[model samples]
Target chain A: MKKGKWGLIIFGLVIFIVGVTFPVWYGAGTSAPAPVLDMDTPVIKSMPNKKCVEDTAFIRAHHMKLLDAWRDEAVRDGHREYTAKDGRRFEKSLTGTCLQCHSNKSAFCDRCHNYVGAKPSCFSCHIVPEEVKK
Target chain B: MKLLLPIIALFVVALLAACFAWAEAVSLLTILAYTSFLIFAAGFVYRMMKWAKSPVPFRIPTTCGQEKSLPWIKTHPLENPANAWGAIGRMAGEILLFRSLFRNADVKMIGGRPVYGSAKWLWFFGLMFHGSLLLVALRHLRFFTEPILPFVNGLSALDGFFEIGVPALYLSDAALLAGLTFLFFRRVVLPQVRYISLFTDYFALLLIAAIAMTGLLMRHVYPVDLSAVKTMVAGWLVFAPVVPANAGVMLYLHLGFVFVLLAWLPWSKLIHMGGIFLSPTRNLINNNRSVRHLNPWNPAVKVHTYEEYEDEFRDKMKAAGLPVEKE
Candidate 1:
């Protein structure tokens, strides 16, 4: 049994090395940005206003949750006003409020979302003007 | 092999996870995931190759019931498969439903009397644990695909069909926990099992349980930004990982445990998943009388031919008056 197995282990380890290094053969294409994710999209030169409902870190992590809460507030609970942590208030609607500052979505939204590979379904229901890249 | 190593191994995983959390090093998590999967896939393929390449030198099948013998005697076809097709059917049963584990029966002494009874609870929880784990893994494909496959959506819907909360309660969550708890308790309760249980066995089981618990916590308790998670996963899939700053410590902890599972799989007995199929006792056909099975590793034997023996002992045989063919 030992004699039989040792031969197999030697032959199999060689194959295992080949199998593990498969990324070397097929990973070249995957390493670069995909065609769908156009990496060189135009950048947003400026925003309508510098103030956001939440800070950058919170917005980066909890944007979807905040958006979901905002949607429930506006549509389900009939509350339109959202008071931010810094005493700023904004309307609770994706198209009406969030889109006001980040109107250039191709440059602002698509760039980051595409970079991070996030495809939010907000636009599945709501209509918005396409951002014309400069 | 001992209690200390697995505990220390688990502690190392936990400590590494904490450091990542403290540093907010989400990219490190992504890198860990990539490397973990590479090793897992490679090792899995390697082990499978080894199994496939290994030679079975004898027809040694374990027969659980009456084999094919006299025409008058009834044979149990499923339990003691005699042919290749029968073996296939049996293998299917074993793989899909764990037929061997299902056959467990406990014999015990009760008040100085011998008693035999069914031990099906182990089978039940084992099935539940494995089945729910597969379902949960399948449900997680939502993070990898774009425009979400309808089947994936359908699976998630079915898993969370209860609709109990904001995020919906996945039924597998409860089943997994119940199964793990039952299995763990049984291991602790049974004296024989407790005595034989190694630290690695407990460590693997507890690690998976912790992973499942953390997953439940993330879902029903402190739901993370799934969109952000999807983004990171999609990036990982396409070689463009973007670890979201918002993905909290819980997600990292869960992933850390999974990474450990993947890394330890090839080295551990968990590899029995692939080994069972290659097992000669389970996979071989029980038709030794009907067919000659060659032993590939049969060693050559040194022998004295009858002619040579007769020639060498002829004088002695004649003198001693022993019968000899040549004489």
Candidate 2:
């Protein structure tokens, strides 16, 4: 009962220090060059307009939310027409539009997801098409 | 009269959160959220380490049982633990069940007769308050996790089993409010309790109540964009934080109250959260008679040796016919 808690002190410090570096160390597993996320993935570069439904910066910051909102609107609320700022219209479905060009999820989505060690749940329910597999 | 300052303090904090929300101070909120977590965890760990610094130089566990000596006499393992394992069991019981508080009783003169009964309501409400608060925290993990665990989903589902509204009302929310109300009122209604209640005690109750109320209002009345909230949380997880452009005022208020709670935890009586685990009385085994306890703080002092005493006493001993070693 009177003994020093050196075990507890060491344990607490280990958990705290290791936990602090978990996100960075978890994703940075290999020294190999990470794949680039770009518009020139052979599909988007071939399109007439190399633009998404939103501005480039906005899309980068809010693509996940946009996708989530689209899911609720299309699947839950049953309203699907999503108008892009440039007067183009598209169905508010992830698999229908967003994944069409970014069909190579392993390349584009996983590149960022794996790099950040973020496990986005989109692939939990959505499947890769027969022709889309790398 | 004393409660005025804390009340104003609570109002000011609530106002700040609302302001942050309306202004869409996303980056500030992000910074505040992470800073709050770091302060809470670090402060708690620091306090725990501080407790470890003091040496409890005696086996002075609070015991209410016969000592473990005579073979024929029965020993209460829990009340007076003879060893470490028994001490662990006692600590676990106290921590998990609030065993001492459960035994609380208050006598009242009813019809010129002293009445004695279980303070079941006090125990029940206290249990409800802490239990519901824990469950509510667990339910919020949905906003933090990507493929949020099944247990979190299941906990929220169980909490909202009544399904009373658009967002599905949670039983924990209601229980938390009711329990807080009871505790707050008890402090005000009972003269003895009210007399002893400091401003901080009332402030703690009101603060948590406000948090629960504002949280419920956000979920049920003026809802924030939850998907946006989750996205921000996910970004925070990956060290790629982005403040949401449209996260509303209620979220800010709820978060602000949480910030205050985190900052106050290490300094508040609420630190019993960690203290319960470290409490010597509750955690130590009662084995003073069986084992010798040494005080590390007690240092050896210069002393006159028996031989020295005899050497000095030799002249007197020769006159008084006393035995002397030096003589």
Candidate 3:
């Protein structure tokens, strides 16, 4: 038990030393770079200039319709139809097929959103379809 | 059987990690880190294959509500799921909310009388730890991508809502550290838990703690050049590995710790993340009686019918003056 305690103490000390020395070593030798952006320059565009969502309900309805269409397509493609105990037959899609039609992600949404500085992280996991012609 | 091999591999990895730490050579550390990852990947695939081959003769999903029975009896279909939809709903709840664990209880002897109490502490800690870690991971997206996302910025704002530090400390980081500490201490201090605890459990907790601690130290105590770190990470992500010459040793240690954690994940109990979906109790609904569940993987076999067995015994039954099927 004593040995174990001492081992933990030593490990903690090593980590602490490493933590303390790292910045001193890295920062000391390196020359500081000039600030990339000017303070006076607008960091982001005004939100009023962005494409407005007039009706969220309309958007949701359209989204649901698209979802239903995709679901139907998935079933038509010989995907295994699972009959739920509730008597609903549904087929799961592996990758969302909406990207087939809506291929150029940036053109579809990113253009205006990027201009408005409203970038979303969805693209991190998802890739824009490169093959689809604009 | 495959699990035993990873345990052995972990020991070999620990040795290598120790050696790299001592030597402090970038090449040696990189080799150690990537090699560990390769071993982990191979082991994961092998283990998954073994699982896929394993025979499950029963539909044994754990149900919390009334089973489907007589027509007069009311069935709690959603909770005790007699069908796939209900099962899916239950699975979603289990996965998202840890529904089963939320309902867990701890038993204790109170003055020689057995008592059960809510074990919500585990659920609370688990939720906080997982949720905060996820948020932290999302917040890290800025480092990997060329242009930072608005959602990442929004999430960063939300995490640093308290605005406690000079650079505005992320609340998720504090929550994550606290949650991990609680979990680690729970394993060590709790008598029953401690008894069941293996070195692997302690090792995993320690490793995560180390990772979190290093990250905190890097951010607060030893701030690295964010742009440089981002460039290095982005390069790695794009398959163009750049070992920046002046990248802080602390960053290397942090990355090393992360790689170690990733390698350990598949082999350790952390595989529970994947295993939860595979768990018979959580995934399966209690509808065995209602539905004829034929084991799809069961091999076809010839069977002797009751009539055939009775036919052979009929002559012996007549000699003994017993009722015979023929008579």
Candidate 4:
């Protein structure tokens, strides 16, 4: 076998050995805790409550109107012709334009969501614009 | 040829995992977590560097449209992009829609006659597999963050739209497993694919399967304290890195397997995810005639001019009655 193949084999072996030995090093034991469902506790909920507003239809209509306004703004800002891979042209919308208002995510979204029961995963991978503190 | 070893490795790991139940032992869980983390961290970095250093000697972009020549011909600019912007657009379509795979065809011999069939199954399966996996990954975000996002809740609701179980059944967990199984079976059972299958390929599929299996086991069989697990994950995310004492062994094994997969990603065939962008065939335009592609890395070299060559071979040419530049 080539040296490279041998190296790979050795590496795989090392990984396998480590995986096997890990359980040995750390004792295998389980401790089950009582399940608690506390609704009032504000730990770290991150999702916005779509149910907070009474009228869904009104909210959707407002959202659409906001989107139309955003589309017009995008067009005026020279971001009108959004061409896709299938040679299709689309006009860009600004309604769900995350970067615009939520430039400071924790400030804009988190404070409200934390008050309710929503905790989103956006903070996990992305840096909250507010957290940068520049 | 190297396919046998990974299978053996997988079986060995699974057997070991079965032998050491995390619920029964905490030390084992810690060992597994730390070991897997180390392997994952070291392995991933090594693989990425190796890929980044690999040499590409030719421009081999796969094109499906007309070349950008003779203005009247009308090039399919997006499909076969001639510039960076067009390439980006094409890449986005490919990544998001699997456009090429969507246009895939299957050929078979039916009663001695060659038949071409629209093979949408591959595309459908690919979409389902990837989409489901994305949902599953996104769903996992609930376990890693503090207060769960409403989008995640909504996504979970949408995923378990049928609402078959008490906590709600996630279609992705089942679909991902089934899709992976199908893909794995295709590699092993199909004579054509089996012949070309490498150990690493099988290893990747098995590792993913193990992760999914462990995750499912934790949810249904063992019933882990997800709140604690989430807290632990959140700590890790926030750079605090708190190892939860209450977290189950299955979770460790699952996390270990996931870490191994991540570490293996940059080095293995999985790098194709990133390499697709670097792929000359996928990204480059077939415009050899329209534009000169001088290798950016090419060094300035002294050239042997025709005059110098003739001067060197003048005597030999004269002796042989051959025409020479000097003569």
Q: Give the winner by TM-score.
A: 1
Model 3, position A25, has a per-residue lDDT of 43
What are the fnat scores of the candidates, in the order listed?
A: 0.09, 0.03, 0.00, 0.01
lDDT of 4 by residue, B1-327 (tens): 466788788767765665555444545545555565566556654554454456544557677788688878998878778776787788778877888888888889999999998877667777777778889988765554334556776787677776544234578988999888888887888798898988888998888888899988876555554445654544444434455645556776776677567657756887565445445566555567766667657899889998988888889889999987666
- Compose the digit string of candidate 1's lDDT tens values, residues B52-74: 76776677788888888899999
Q: Give lDDT tens digits, candidate 2, residues B106-169.
A: 7889999999877867888998899999999877766655455567777876888875654568
- lDDT (CA) per prediction: 0.74, 0.76, 0.61, 0.61
Question: If ranked by DockQ, best first, what sequence of candidates would result?
Answer: 1, 2, 4, 3
lDDT of 1 by residue, A45-124 (tens): 36445556798667755676788788788889899999999888888988777776666667667755544334466787
State how far residue B121 of model 4 sits from its true place (Å).
2.3
**Evaluated with lDDT, which candidate comes out highest?**
2
Worst 10 residues of 2 chain A by lDDT: A26-35
For candidate 1, report its TM-score: 0.72
| lDDT, candidate 4, at B177 | 90
lDDT of 2 by residue, A61-104 (tens): 45766777787888898999999888889999888888778777
Better of 1 and 4 by DockQ: 1
Pairs that collide, model 2: none
Most DockQ-accurate candidate: 1
Those runs of model 3 whose alpha carbons end farther than 4 Å from true positions after fitting are A1-134, B1-24, B28-42, B295-327
Q: Which ten residues in a row have the lowest lDDT in candidate 1 chain A?
A: A35-44
Better of 1 and 2 by lDDT: 2
Against the native chain B, each candidate's TM-score is 0.88, 0.90, 0.82, 0.79
